[model samples]
Target chain A: MIHQISVFLENRSGQLAEITHLLAENGIDIRAISIAETSDYGLARMIVNDAPKASAVLLEAGVILSMTPVCAVEVPDAPGGLAAFLQLLAEAEVDVEYMYSLFTHRAGRAYMVVRVSDETALTAHDIKLVGMDELGLK
Target chain B: MANYYQPEIETASYEQIRAWQNERLVKQVQHVWDNVPYYRQKMEEKGVTPADIQGVDDLHKLPFLCKDDLREAYPYGLMGKPLADCVRIQSTSGTTGRRVVAFYTQHDIDLWEDCCARAIVAAGGTKEDVVHVSYGYGLFTGGPGLNGGSHKVGCLTLPMSSGNTDRQLQFMTDLGSTILCCTPSYAAYLAETIHERGLKDQIKLKAGIFGAEAWSEDMRHDIEDSLGIKAYDIYGLTETSGPGVAFECEEQTGMHINEDHFIAEIIDPDTGEVLPEGSKGELVFTAITKEAFPLLRYRTRDICVLTRKKCSCGRTHIKMSKPMGRSDDMLIIRGVNVFPSQIETVLLQQGYTANYQIIVDRVNNSDTFEVMVEMNPDMFSDSLAKIADAEKELVGALKSMLGIAAKVKLVAPKSITRSEGKAVRVIDKRKI
Candidate 1:
């Protein structure tokens, strides 16, 4: 299952670089990342190659990290793919908390990682649940 | 000759002061090296010894003690004496994690009481007056520090820790409290409360000693005008023996450092280099007389200017201006340095109630700062646009004051949570 890991980061220049450097140093490849911030600090949500290992690495480095399950859907790069998925989730009574589009690899196909309440509803919609291995993250 | 209470030792000449400090410095260095392994190792690493510290000028030869040093030595790491000698333990509430505890021997407590008594006397408090101590008690050092000092001054002291404003006022009126001790914000609220209840005449408060938080001159004037009392500022930290390290005399110009007990220094916050007396820098203190946990060059992080110019009050002790703000309290909002006191200054200047909250959130990788201010009942109305305009005006004022754009939301009176003790004014939702 796609897991959303919140990496607590101080709001400073090159803070992202420091975090990314730590992740790279630990060989924890970030599949997708999005940043949410407040004035003093920020939360960086990451879909990593190894959620548990990345969490441990971050924690050992004295970085506060929180894990939440997110649904990763393989959608076509064509227009309205996200809207359709969101509409489907809405109709299924699964409220999306937050989401971010994962970077595309191939010429046409794209994917999005969404944090939602009901993972069961997302899995039931024939939305293939992408894991670290499935995305060749590691 | 000065008054008997104002001892020459307390306000010794600079040359004599240096000699006294150097003597204690030598003793303290040897005491720590022989007893506290932590200090011994640190000194060994830096190749520093008791002989190297010849005077106060050579203080930089010793390492500066930060708050982290205290945390690392948690529970009782910093104690220079055996645990049996410690009579009291006071701590700062660790909103982050573990509280920083400082042990005080009975002798240490007496010294602390004497310093606080000096503060009371500096504020012109007398034995005939009733002293109301409103500093929060328990692990916090503010309450007991002042309470003991009030008793030492032979005043009828009310050890009313904090909260229960109604009872605070009732006692103020019933007992005729002439001296009030509390954080400046609470003093302002108390003034407002007395006016609200029409008990202005019933209260007998004439002077206030406010500290434990950084406040501005405007705030001092606000509290003084509202409460019909002279407000004096005091300065100290739990590590340095609580709220009696320095105090404002009747002149209210600056807080006079009790140089006999604590050697005061101004150092660059980042570099720790000692600055000139008139320059603004972080204040550091070395406890010369404290027995149990005598801190040497404890960095206070408070940004203020120190002056040796003789005050009109005739006290020869070096005076420090009211702290502008703490280096640690500087909040980085959207790449801009913002201090909560700046927001407070703006709010007070705008004629709005101080019951406000600063909310920070991240939106699209950018920091968003929002200030929510509670409308005073007298100025509130049902008109939405008018209220919004008022909020916009406040936002504009804050932007000007802090040099950062902030969104201001005017909330209904009583909407902002009222704290009986220390108010929680800053909410960084971004951290979540």
Candidate 2:
């Protein structure tokens, strides 16, 4: 299990840029970023190099955020890797709320974080689950 | 014991106050009948002569005067004394309808100042304290009214007359201002500025007299907490003299009306029938002692209740509850009387900013009530479900407070345009 930072972004042009700028100013690198938006607001989720440090800095800068627990898994850097992971989840009836790819790959192994109802089924299937420290992220 | 500007009148028995009202109201009726032909015409149209009004009880026999009548009697029609005797004229902001010019003679100004002196005294002000008057000066009554009252109280009066925040701060700190006089919003702004500038220690304000606008009790405590001073609300209209008509005592419950000068009554806004004491209705005043502009049965349009309940402050003058809202500002959404203050109270209790906008419109033959609040960082949430929960909670609380459900929308912080003077709180788009 790894931590992901989700920020509430008002549907304004510079809101996301402001948050990202503050993150860069604090030397916290965003490993991956995805934005899901509605008409009036957006929820921007990020996998950062330093989740804890980034959370503290963003919070101190008055950004509204929540630290969500997600399963980080390393799969073969091939198209069927994601398909195989989805098939495993389907067999276990695991509900995936959302999933996004990590920016960095290690030795041709792509990393993806999945927010799910329960991750015990994936671990039961002996899937490769990675954490921030295991992936050598700060 | 409460400090009083005039003990004889301030603590006068009900009988004494009644006698003064009886004697003065009768003379005032005749004063208007003879001097202000507009009021005389109104009295005659109601088929009531000066001979018909003998005392305060006969007040209802006289016709009620509304703002429309005042607007119709524009420049000088409402003047009871000629320009020769009039020493000063203070006008209303006239944001709602038309600007009303109220004239005051030397004696009128003296009495009005005396009323303000009582307010200052009630707020724990003393001659030794430096009183700062920030209410707008020239045409607006707040500045001049409090200025005169501060003089009567013998406080070192700083006639700041609003604006120039830096100068206000310099004077406040350097002069050691003890009492602040301004609208509630300005007081809040000043408090915010003080904290932002980190000048809290230099601030010497012990008490604040805030008025000329509607504010909630929640806003009162906020100002008090921020400024480290007790905030008192003063209620008045430019029509019935100005900011010192009724003022809050240390009791912190209600404002004691200066019954010796003006007679107050509550009346059903629609039927024009005087409601019994303690009934919430549109406030009506008869300036029995005002020389230049004597208004008879002048409807204040502020909806408030009067209480004869014994006050610990020991002032015998009747106390008027803080007005719920001016009758004109009251919104009837689906037949429920909803005040913006009610929504404000709910918002503050839910840890939101006091600055909010209420938008009302009509659709499909029904009224739609919606409140737009800024999404401050503290109350923001990342989850859509959590954000929806926040909105739902606000809607539920507003429904309970307003007796009608209002849709709550959270926009970006500081999105609504706040005016230079007076933040626009309500927008009614109904063409009705």
Candidate 3:
């Protein structure tokens, strides 16, 4: 259950390159990005490669976005793979309100994408959860 | 059934309007001690003269007059009647600091258009109706005091001055306008452009008066349900002779004050004393029939309450009420007249950081405003399109220092809200 997106900008400067140039001119690929800001607007949040065609090219370029369902796991690209998956969501009490990471060209892998305030800890992490047609690189 | 352009002085008798405000405060304190020597040197330095004002209970022994004594009596030191007995001059939108002006006399524009024809016969108007007005003509006594009170209530007037909300609804639906006179935020911007042009059944309004600014009874029931009429509330002041000096009958509870040509009085705005009648202070006014600006115990930094109750539309003078706040920090927005030190003198003349706030709310029923400001660690490291072109050059230097339009937000660099004593610079949220 991965599908992210989120937007809503206006803390100005080329609004994250105007939403990554309308998702790289509609060939979408971002795979993991975060922003959050505040003091007058900013959200951003990505993990694209076409979350429904970057939410219809950022809603026909007027842009202010949304689309959630997150959890993407996969860790071990070495060093205790995200401290043993955050010590198995702190021994399954599970509550990671936010998390981010990327780096996948295989070789010992890496992903991390969480956003969990407990939605059944998305099936208590049987570990490998990176769906969207298995992120086989665009 | 309440149309009184002057039913024996709008239903007189509180002992016949205190015997016509004790015979016009004894002939306007012998006409400001025989023609204003700066209110006879503030009544000879409050030693009290005009034979110690012999009526309206010696109007608290005269001498108040504020706004820095009309900016130290600028042009013609409060002219009681010279300049060949004045015929006009209105002024004051000097937002705040110079530019009061005033004068009038043609019997002070026939008693300021008979107190704006008793607020268009207490907003039910006649002369087979059609008024219109739209306040803001020349030196601004709200469009020649309701265009000479819709030509002394013989209606059919128009003189549409304010802005052009689509040719003021094309002469308010091709001249069938049955009274509307402006400034309750331009009648909530002509009732939001007649419900956004669906032209509320081709308009034929049946009453509205409003006033230069400050409006709320939930924006008078949202401009009386988007202009289906009955919106009243008129009160005046271009130093006592502008909108109409108090109106609202049909008993929408308060206003009434023409107290036989102005007398009002609440006081104690920091020790000027006199508060008694239902407390809550600072409104003042004396003008007892202004013959070319006759302000006597003036000091109206407005904040109100005056009652005398008893009225289910019977109008026996003294009502006041709707001013409720402002012994100075000005504000009013949408109906123009703002003041946070005129947005901190256009943010310290455009260099910024006097840290800001403003806010003011009420959306669809008009007036929103905003402001916010703060960004100053070298404008918080600039470059967010140069902080949105410095919030569009501080919304064009606060719409040229408060003639209106605001929404300039910039926040984050100390994020607004610092105080140790009195810096809560306006929030408003219009519940009035």
lDDT (10s digit) by residue, model 1, range B62-89:
8888877887988777888899988889
Q: Where does model 2 sit among the CAPRI classes? A: incorrect
- Per-residue lDDT value at B315 in model 2: 92
lDDT of 1 by residue, A75-133 (tens): 77889877788788888999876778887577677788876778888878877667766
lDDT score for residue B370 of model 3: 92
For model 2, the DockQ equals 0.21
lDDT of 2 at B220: 85
Q: List the residue pairs that clash in candidate 3.
A: B105-B108, B136-B143, B216-B219, B216-B432, B217-B432
* Fnat value of model 1: 0.00
For model 2 chain B, give the 10-residue run with minimal summed lDDT.
B330-339
What's model 2's TM-score? 0.61
lDDT of 2 by residue, B1-432 (tens): 659889888998999999999999888888888898888887889899989988988989998888789889888988888799998998865432356789999999999999999999999988898999998898778999999999999999999988899999999999999999987778888898899999999989999998876566777888899999999989888888888999999998989999989899999988999899989999999888998888888887778999999889889889899877566766655534466777888899888898789998765334677888877766765467677777789888877666568888777666767899567999988553
User: In model 1, what is chain B's TM-score?
Assistant: 0.77
lDDT string for model 2 (A1-138, tens) is 888898877777899999999999999888988888777678899989898899999888767678877888988898798999888888888888788898774677898888877878889987889977886676
- Where does the lowest 10-residue lDDT sum fall in candidate 3 chain B? B377-386
lDDT of model 2 at position B231:
94
Preferred candidate (lDDT higher): 1 or 2: 2
Q: Candidate 1: which stretches are off by over 4 Å?
A: A1-138, B1-4, B96-98, B329-432
